[model samples]
Target chain A: MSGKPVIVFDKVSLYVEGRRFLDRADLVVSEGESLVVAGAGGCGKSFVLRLILGLPGMGRASVRVEGDVVVDGHSILAEPLPALQRRRRNMGSVMSGGGLIENMDVRKNIALPLNYHYGNVMSTAEIEARCDAILGDMELEELALPGRRPVSLNRMERIYVALARALVNQPNILLIDEPTTGVSAAAGERLARFCFYYRPEFPSAPAAMEEMSGRPMTRIITTVELEPYLDFGHRFALLANGKIEEIGDREAVLGSADPNVRELLSRSRKVASPGVDDADSAELPPGGGSCWRRSDSHWCHQGDRVKEGEEGASGRTAQAR
Target chain B: MTALIGPIQGLGAQVCEAFTNAWSLLMFSVDSVAAVARFFSRQGFWAAFRVSLQQVHFTGLEALPFLSLLSLLIGFTVIVQSLPQLQGMGAHGLIGKILVISIVRELGPIVTAMIVITRSGTAMAAEMATNRISGQVEALEAMGIDVFHYLIAPRVIGSMVSLFCMVIYFDVIALVGGFLVASTQLTMPWILYSDYILESLQPLDLYISLSKSILFGFVITLFSCYHGLRAKRAPYEVPMVARSGVIQAMFFVFVSSAVISAVFYWI
Candidate 1:
């Protein structure tokens, strides 16, 4: 919490296909604190990740980055692709839907970033050793082998493999999107714990490897669900209708007058309460009441989904607001 | 008046889009050239070397049989279509000269380019587009790998080398096919036909043929990469870009062939 800011989005606006996706958004995350950006579907969470990654130029439509996005105290938009790519390496991303390169097997997918960064300098044996250590830390020794294809793996296995790939390079900033969409609730909570406090401290790992992985990282994670991540982060940012509606310490914002914030909290309460039915959950948006907080760091399942609890929760939250 | 304004505005937008596409294509070309130069140092020599070898296999070796077949068919058709008129005029001696001029100097390069455009160029565009949509391209960029150097430069260089080799293959098959047909049907001597064909093939013709093949190869790969990069972030855009990429590549091939042919033959 005492570290300097690692990421800064200053009045950034993004317009895609003649429709504004993000409007003058601003946010800052200090080193070593995970910031969860919660928003509904189509609320620019994905665009925010792409924008910070400086991906506006790669698409067909004209991309205009109106303001500054500084990561590690440098202007990412001002730099070109090759330069931007180098800067991007300092950050790791677990893409939505697990963007494993289909052509490469699980081991190669994990080894790709390392090979890219250290291919020129490191010996092949050294790279393999690093990859082995990373695999061990993620506890993926048995399920994923060097030759196992990504498609052959189950959903939870893919998420774990993707997590290994994102952490392989020991990036200073880790970006994850919708980390719990396809996995069991228990698996989701375990993955979230790893994201929050991952340090490569395996006994078999080399000292230098430990040193590289032990550095403080600034993590930025985006999810549609609020309860699973409610008390997991030092700060929270709520995005609604193409704008950051609220951003503050978790408790303050939870208790804020913002209608969106109140709605999110009440939705969390409904999800946490037992006996919610699927029919009610179907009416809400994706990740609406399907997740809730168990304690300070763990996420627990409340119901199959919110069914009868939807109307009651809405009425209660509206009265509270 | 409103109708006229709407049409005018649409036309203006089209013109603007055309210029923008042209500019983007030019920039992509420059970036690709730079990536090629930087490949050895930035991407490492062995990685680029392996990719180049793979491309040679994909674009050249795998395409050999098809190119050979097409060239043979064209050679046979041209000779057969002209056989009656040449026999009546007692002008069998000119058959070799016609083959060398039409098949070797022109058809060999253009046909090879066309086949390559249809096969490898479209595949490369679709592959790149799929990679883009599937987040593989972004993954590469995120990992600090230069997508241009890693994905594009090797393919372009590989296609150029492959097209250059295929032109030789096309020329040999066409001329040999024409020679066999002439010898059997027209009772022409092998030594005489060879001598006549060799005599007709000027150094300029050889230069033009090789140059055209290389230029066509470069244009096709460039257009494919440009269009593939232009594809929007949707699965449907993959096919759309692939189709447009093929069209643009063919258009450039024909246009460049005309310009080069005019400069060599007419000018």
Candidate 2:
């Protein structure tokens, strides 16, 4: 069971606008293994995730999730709607903005996955108790009430709510995009530690729900750059254009002088590099997440927009828009 | 004549496409209705209905003041034109009858339909377009929630109810406006106005007018939702959908009003 691959993208390729986005991407991950697939934006980082997620039937490529994507020992493509829903319950994905429902307050939105997946498994008392513990654990003491809608809260608060919602199900797999891209470096480190540290603290949570699906022991396979934004992934796979060039530890992927790997890294730096985008360059705070300004009464974004660094300043990228 | 036949035939084909698309949309609406009924138990029908009511308030009530003002100007202008013509024959007393017939039998429904089409109709389309763009529609779908019921059924119901109420409001204002103009500008006697209005206006006229508005309400909601829900995922598509909604609503109302008038006359 440990050797069984949870997700396997077999020689998959995707094309958009009649031009190939990803030529052929082949990758595999087994239970209890954490991984980070890193590449420049538009270099098919999301394309890889999309195939594993089965967003489209075939994006000019064949995709197969070998062991189980949504549940244990079952192919995601073959599962029924109800079965697929059950699989999705075992996992949750968080985009950079956290995709909070604008109308529902933070608390209700966070409570959603709990109600969807485990309402019957956990009693009313246990559910409330668990929710309370998590809120305190994340230090979201004030936001636990979910009083205000998403629009009112600052960006970091929204990320806190987003992180809280992802953890509500105590999922086996968390597919996250740009986890640290919007928050302060300190907060990003805290988020990275929280996700990486989950393996040890809540080891029992995933096993308890193992009977619902085949795989358990909540493992996170995500995508990120370890040198700057985060530091704790077990594996980093080099992705360039639309293919995985190398798969190894951080030292190997980073230290390697492979032409393709060097090219991919060089290209990633250029994406946010103001030299190419100097036409509309703004001052960015030395560390990147989201760059915006907010006073008590004013939220003006004038001059060169540099990513700001502060407790709440980092995660407000989505809101600053 | 041959050139005329080609375009006329093409128009017949396009109208047929509208009918076919409408039928497809009706089937989709039925599916959503069933899904919404299922979720009704989760958040009681009254609560869901209340949310829908809020949609109407934002979508409907906000536009009423301007619509009423337009109706007033239309009524005053129409009566001004009618007075000189009616007076030429020494039948100036017919002013009230003319106003009543024009306002209730024709202008009320047409104007109401146009307003709903421009305002609520475009609003619904843009909202759905944005929902599609923001992945809200997909979010609803992923929850095993039928989008038609949760996203669209509410708007359809809201548009129908809102359009009807607005038309009634528009009709009332137009009448008062016509009366105010006749009394002040024409120095017409109150008895003449009242007698003419009472003698010419019928319950059937009001019923027919209201009924046409209901049909207008249905068409506006249908066209807007159909185009909006089927929006492209691109950013600019939302604006495109909104523009197309206005055009489609106008086309639908024109055909619907003509058919409705023909039917009323035949009956």
Candidate 3:
């Protein structure tokens, strides 16, 4: 990770409906780094992403922020609407459950940002070309046809489309919330890879990653389950009791004392070791390949199920390192 | 004293709530006007203009047939009722004056506004509420697109244009239809009828009718959008907001039209 900080959460606290959701949380993510924040369901995991985007929470309850959230050296809480809009232009966000416009089809949804921002400068053909390129990169060219609204797509397809929309702008920073919520574990891994890494096999992969400054896109991904992002994230943080209990490198987070952290680690371990817990391994399909494997000095996992024995799982983990 | 205290407290609370709502609505109106100015001055003019055109098509064009029928019926009724009464009073020459005063100055703008409120105003509110509940509005904000520029401004402009055009259409159909229907009963020349209406019509009458149309348009749309966006997230809130929007828009259209008429004619 680079030393230049792209996002800084300086002792931030958020209260909704007179109840504390975040308590003096401090997080600093540098340029070109991906941070995975893991928490249980309803623990305000999505709220963090909304906070970065300067959005109100889901319901009508009043929300109050006690501390500053600085993104790209600008204090988002203090900025005017126009300044915030300008800042948002440089950042891409994938909301939970794929917040696509319902009336517009998939093509229009993805083309929205480009059309709104560059419609005056770029021709319609050029705009469509950029949208087509991003859709191709996300392997969603088939769904790019008109009349394919978000409601028509499955969860995985919707998330992929949301990703394509987020990346079409070539934003410098990306904020994703629960990308792998309802999809299978294998699909989740692929989605995570698409967010963080650029594969050479995809023709427009460079277009997705190519910012104006030529630096890697900074990403902050929030998930309820840690297994999906374990391989790709540069650092991991455990959120519990309205605070980030543990945040560090993957090894440091894995070795932290937080019970939530421990539970997630144990759950990941069970997924990595198949026969060790047959009950948990049920999520793995019968003819599926081994979920856990060694790849590029990382523990790349397919499914969130534990399949092999502890010895085999540890051996793979050791090899992965 | 204790019993009176409870009632007084409740009344005070209601008053406070009313004031709060009024203040909120006033602020929203100011923000909406400012957003329109900013939208025109900004970069996404054509994109937002396309949305404005679509709104015009939906709000103005689609309602044309219904408006035409209603205007013709109203025109025939007014002329049929008033011409005989004027002839009996030996004031047959006042046909044009009566038509201009009743239809052009009042009924044309008010009735057209009522139709738009029933049709387009409710739709705008419900659509905006649904978009909010579905997270589309939040998504638009996250994408750096101004909600006011893309959504509110287009709807406001479209409603104003639609109401203005519809009022004129209503007035013409009412006058012409009234004259045609009355001619069958009274044996009056078409030229005489036409001359009477043209003579009775004044620039002041036109100004009042057009002003009411534009004001009614602005009030209806602004109220609908304000109520619709008040919906936070729940699915059930959609209908509730839509109903509130329609009620408030109707109320404001009546009140504002009355106030404007009173200012122009009575005061």
Candidate 4:
């Protein structure tokens, strides 16, 4: 984590349906840092991401937000719609269902942001080249056919396409919302792996390209299932009951004194080592613990199948490897 | 007293909500127009222009055959039904006046608008509602593409342009159909019948029809786009909004037709 903060939530509170979805939530995410927000279902994890993106419902009237949310050095709430949209150009969001436009084919969906922002400045060849680089980087070139709609791709491919779309603009801040929520566990593992892929390089327009090209990206990912997100970045904020129950280095939060934080870690461990009782899963695996889930007498972690006897409970953690 | 107050409050709330919705629709239509203006000056003008052309092709060109056929039928029926009475009374000269004053001035714009409301207006509403339901609208906005510019403007401008052209086409076709049918019965030369029709067709009638068509197009596009954009997230809302949009568009078309015709003819 760097010394400077790139994203800050200064006592931000969001009220929805006369209930506080996020109240006085405060956190600082440094530039180039990735923070995995872990919480129970409906803990406003996605809501916070929406707030950061300045989506329509995250405002004074609808969600009734209070306090300030500053992203990439500007108050998101203060900016008007167009200004917010301009600011959002630097932020890439992979919303649920990949937020791909069903009307557009896969290639157009990926190129939508590029065509919107730099359509005037960049040539068709340049835009295509950029899009090709992103697809190649995301390993989604197989589905980049000219006329292929989003429905043609399965759940996992859609998520990948969404990520590719988000990253096509080379946004500095990547806000991913539950990329693996509805996919098979195997696909979820692949999605987890795809989230960490490198941004592609291009020699096109230097202004939008330079800011995100060499600089380390700051990613804030929210997920319902914490197992897939366990290894993301170095920092973790445990959000529960519309508040950050615990926030610090991943290790510190994992071992925090807050019961909710401890419980969440334990729950994630349970997801990783399913079929094993809580007593047997006591020792937390070291260095970005394995996201392996034991199902039907085999260990599945990152698509590798290991028999239970050969890879005992202690040897299952393979995310860092 | 309590019962009266309850009913009164409920009515007041309903009125307020309706007024708010109307105001929001107006504002959204205005914003769409402004975005279209901006679209003209910006680099995206060509893309938006292409979309507008496609819309015009869909709403106007593709609709040409059906609209022309309907106009012809209408003109034939009006002339056929009224010719006997006029001939019985020896008022054959008034046939051109009747055709010009009725079909060209009144029926042409209103019927064309009704067709548009059924075809493009409902489709626009459904499409807009689908965009909202499927998250395409939000997705566009999130990508920094203005929803008004990218989605609504082209449809509005295209439909308006298409309606104007359709009205003119309908007028011409209807008059031709009336002339063809009247020639068989009246025993008049083609040139004299054409002259009578052309002479009765005052420039003021054309002006009124053209203005009404433009207004109808604007109203239909505005209402459909507004309703579609405002649809709830539920799947059922898509059909509901389309239905409501069509109904409202038709209502506005009829009312505008009456108001515009009265102002142009009666006043």
Cα lDDT of model 3 by residue, B1-267, tens digit: 999999999999999999999998999899889877786878778878888888889888999999999999999998888877887898878888988988999899999999999999999999999888888888899999999989898889889999999999999898888878768877789899889889999899899899889888888889999998888889899899999999998888888878888998899
CA shift at B100, candidate 1, in angstroms?
Answer: 2.0
Roughly what TM-score does model 4 have, to 2 decimal places? 0.86
- Which is superior by TM-score, 2 or 3? 3
DockQ of 1: 0.34
Candidates, DockQ? 0.34, 0.05, 0.58, 0.37
For candidate 3, give fnat to 2 decimals: 0.74
Please give, as one word, the docking class of candidate 1: acceptable
What are the per-residue Cα lDDT tens digits for candidate 3 across A81-188?
A: 888998897788999878898878899888888788877766787768877776665556789887887888998888878888887767878889988777655455
Candidates in order have lDDT scores of 0.73, 0.61, 0.78, 0.76
Best by TM-score: 3
lDDT of 4 by residue, B1-267 (tens): 998999999999999999998898778878977986787776456556767898999899999989989999999888999999999999888888999888988899989998999999988999888888777777776677777787778887898899999998998898888887887887778788888888798999988899888888888988898889777678798889899899988988888788877887798
Residue pairs in candidate 1 whose N, alpha carbon or C atoms collide under 3 angstroms: A277-A307, A280-A307, A281-A306
State each model's TM-score restricted to chain B. Answer: 0.96, 0.83, 0.96, 0.96
Q: What share of the true interface contacts does candidate 1 keep?
A: 0.47
Write down the TM-score of every candidate: 0.81, 0.66, 0.88, 0.86
- Over A151-240, each residue of candidate 4 has an lDDT whose tens digit, in order, gives 898877888888888888777788888877776544465466556434545676647666665567777788655555554546677788
Ranking by DockQ: 3, 4, 1, 2
Model 1 residue runs over 4 Å out of place are A21-23, A56-58, A139-155, A199-214, A241-259, A265-321, B1-6, B44-49, B83-85, B89-92, B186-193
Across A1-321, the per-residue lDDT of candidate 2 in tens digits comes to: 245677766566666545565656666766655667777665656555544444432211333333223334566656665556556665656654666767677776676555444554555555556566556656565775646677777776776676667666666666666666555544554465445433212323434455533344333333445443224555667677667765576567678887655654453321342122322222222221112244332232323343344415433431222
Relative to the true structure, candidate 4 has a C-alpha RMSD (angstroms) of 6.3
